[model samples]
Target: MSVPISRLHVSHDAPLLRHVSEHASRTDWCYMHADVASAYHPCFSERLLQQMLQTQERIRRNLAADPDPKAGIHHLVLASDSDVFNLGGDLQLFSRLIRGGQRGRLLEYAQLCVEVAFNLHQLYDDRVHSIAVVEGDALGGGFEAALCCHTIIAEEGAGMGFPEVLFDLFPGMGAYTFLTRRVAPVVAERMMLDARVYPVEELLRMGVVDMVVPRGEGRQAARELIRRNQRIGNALRAMNTVRQACNPVTLDELLKVTNEWVDAAMRLNDRGLKTMERLVRAQQRRAQAAAPALTLV
Candidate 1:
């Protein structure tokens, strides 16, 4: 049976949710990103990811049951939350979901997204390229989501990191696996442990972000990346493959380490802990400042 698209706890009081309901286009940026006004209406919504994953899973099962050397599409460019990319899983909403005996459903959604990430990783290993463009802050699960892409393009001052660590929680969406792969193990650890928000420039220098562009020009630069680097993506995929082949540790072995970290994170309690309060408040301030003003529908 095909997996069902899991429902999200979209707040009825949220202005953005209302915007989504009003503006015919909710989250699909397909033709618009390409600047084809004619193709605008068919924009890719977050629903697109769910649709793509379900289709891919079906095809994958068919292939595994048989064996097809040739299958799958070539390129896919997805737009994240307006400037923020994604705020990861809605922790506030998640708290309510978990309390409602819906943790399994949430877990299922997380697992599906994680599987999609694995597919992207394998695509990179098999010499296929995927690009993710970040226009603003990509926090917690959002950061992990971007890590799944082969090429990550961020805005000049964009913020990126696994801030979930600050919440006394571990990344349940495959952030550990991808972060270690993209940046040095030591550097990734430092970011995870400290739960600091680093600038895109720092991330780019550390190899966490592939490229940084000026504000309002990130999408343009990303398109140019596709134009200029014809074989660059393929080359990167091959390089990653070679490195994995040469590595002594297998993915299974790495997951064990990740589990240990998860266990430790679960034990943490940010309740009454002011450890990251300053940073958290700062982020909140920025979010409030940048948030588009609108009354709830």
Candidate 2:
């Protein structure tokens, strides 16, 4: 059985939850499900980013306090409570900030996002493994977030892409760096420039998604993977360490890219901003309809 972290009768106080719900698994892992309050947009709002940062910090503190690696969280799985994994950044906020010429606010938001992504990439510590369970669409920054995880287990029929190009912007968070690390640079560039949603099958073939299970089986797949990895925990950890060492994505790199993203965002003309607004409207319509459709280009 799983217990909500907040309700668990433990020695330590539970981490606060607003845009995310966290649970402790009986199988020796932590399960984090994203339940963004802004259903219409379902993006990573400022509050959500802050909450995630706090959650990660708590996890790190716990691991540090316990010298026994087995006593602490072995695997961290991230999934969404809604039909969509995540739609991406707060485009509505982005539009408002850009239109108002609030470049500083935009940079701040981008930096926060980078921090979250960087923390996930490092997995707090090498002993812990991070997995992203994408059971639905993950677009733009959302895709970047998933790519930061050590392993990506997606469900069939799920869609993912970098739709920022549709608004004449690229996914500046970590899409390019993460994708290039997994696949070829040309493939990453094409995916970004194409600006169209790709099916999970195509993503799996392209080496973007690590595993694809049947729809609605994402959690089970993740659990099974976690159990298997746990059996060879030491070996798995060492492999991940080698992987990270071989293809390092430093904090400096992510921050530099975020700076570029801020510059590009400020350069968006009225037409581009209007396109972004249209996408926001489309997201709202999808939310109201209660459909699992990806925003079209």
Candidate 3:
């Protein structure tokens, strides 16, 4: 039986959750667009994280029940509805939690983030592949999220980097692990410490971004890649399996790093918190002004 894409129930109507929609032409492809309420500083809020967990669980159940990988979702693509893919962690929330000395809450948030990243890195199942379509700025945790995908297709002018170092912190959630797996550790360290956004082309040259498409064609490029993979999927999947077997990123590693992140976050001083607050204000201003371009901090 050919399972209809509409029957998968991946589409959601939640206001702050990702707006999922079935690809009209590709029955095996699922699209989840980040439709966050904080469009200016679109970070992974608690609500968004919970929704993502639910959606991934649903997909896992669906895939487990279906014997044929081709019948259901074989590809999951994460994109953004706004101009910026994501501005990274919720700085406003972080500042509040840090000031209140809420280490547990910080850990909880970091855990949720790592869990999502791990699931994406695992692709929910061995049969499915995950992709990220970056059309705009993907900074800090946003960049880390993109790195979790098996394939990252960025559009021209799209920016990616880790700006966490700006406020005396590092992108702790899977940034180091993912980047090391994709590139050299030295390169990854440089990127994290640089605190500057790199154009998609630069990342592509560094072999971080898998493909670069013309502006406004990221989705099309992903679709085309899927079409190509349909023919050699088995081989590609086997290769992915081999790659994982050779160099794996475990949930334990992510969790441990997240713990370290929480500890570091708790140690943020008055100066660091002030920097975070300034960034938060900038995000708010960008939101109010409805800026189309993101100048990554």
* Model 2 residue-pair collision total: 0
For candidate 2, the per-residue lDDT at 56 reads 73
The CA lDDT at 173 in model 3 is 92
lDDT of 1: 0.53
- Could you arrange the candidates by lDDT from highest to lowest? 3, 2, 1
Q: Each candidate's root-mean-square deviation in Å?
A: 8.3, 6.6, 5.8
Tens-digit lDDT track of model 3 for 1-297: 111111222334554445454544332333333443333446776666666766666766766776666553367778877777878889998999999999988887888888888888784445667889998899899999999988999999989999888899999999999999888999999998999899989999999999999999998898888888777777766776787789977888888888898999899899999999999999888775654433331
After superposition, which runs of candidate 2 have C-alpha atoms over 4 Å from their true positions? 1-40, 69-73, 291-297
**Least accurate 10 contiguous residues by lDDT in model 2:** 1-10
Clashing residue pairs in candidate 3 (N, C-alpha, C atoms within 3 angstroms) = none
Task: Find the candidate with the highest TM-score and give its number.
Answer: 3
